[model samples]
Target: MDKDASGPKVVVGVDGSESSYAALRWAVRYAGLVGGTVDAVSVWELPGRYGWSAPAVDMDVDEEEARRRMRQELTDVLGTDAAESVRTHVVHGNPADVLLRAAEGAEVLVVGSRGRGGFARVLLGSVGQHVAQHAGCPVVIVRSGPS
Candidate 1:
């Protein structure tokens, strides 16, 4: 949360996907329009449905690696100059849960229609669906592909 300021706080989720980059860009513009600050959150979690009696341990998804990817995603999309306005957050948890937590006191929560996985769709990614249904504030689910 951007609790130190008086303006609106806009929270967005980025997952190092093209759709996520779109969400980040859209959030920046939306924040500019509403005099809000953007909190770009990227979440990592233990792999679900692991076979062979695997535990909730994922060696491939490191927290530091996720943070670096998120940072680089912002830099790639927003560039160094414009990306400064966005405050990045990297968390370890369910993406939906993390975004919902971030949206606790936010004015708006923006996310892409789909993340790195999932079939093609519009209006609701799994994470976006969860957040939109349970968030405390307004939710904006931005579609990435052509309209």
Candidate 2:
């Protein structure tokens, strides 16, 4: 992915979770504050339980659905005007790996305190915890408001 020509880049991971939406909003606001651009990324991975003998699946459809969800989530969180300016990506890979890769050379990597796969009792999601420790740039973990 290309860095924004106008300013620094802010990369944020988005899943279809309230926490992720909060993170997206935070990323956009922070990008505005820093005169940076936002790259809103949604990553999906095939079920690893299937291992080498996984059933055939339509990869294109999966990716497109991810893109659609990302767009819908962005509009839901940031509204059309703000969402339109942010660049979006739908990637197929491990969530943390993809996000960390996307964050390379970025001003900061933003992610939710937790994503869909983690236990609610935990303070941070597995992917968020991983990226916070491994990201090349600074990482911002935006916690969701009280339920």
| Deviating ranges (above 4 Å) for candidate 2 | 49-60
List residue ranges in candidate 1 displaced over 4 A.
48-54, 58-62, 121-123
Candidate 2 residue pairs in backbone clash: none
Error of 1 at 124 (Å): 2.4
lDDT for each residue of candidate 1 in 1-147, tens digit (9 for 90 to 100): 457756999999988777787888899999999998999998776665324365655566567777777777788899987787888888877788889988888989999888877676544668878888899999988877663
User: Per-model C-alpha lDDT, please?
Assistant: 0.82, 0.86
Candidate achieving the largest lDDT: 2
lDDT of model 2, residue 25: 90
* TM-scores for candidates 1 onward, in order: 0.85, 0.89
**Per-residue error at 126 for model 1, in Å?**
1.0
Q: Write candidate 2's Cα lDDT for 1-147 as tens digits.
A: 776446889999888888888999999999999999999998877764235476756544566776777887788889999999899998877888899999989999999999886477888988989998998899999989999
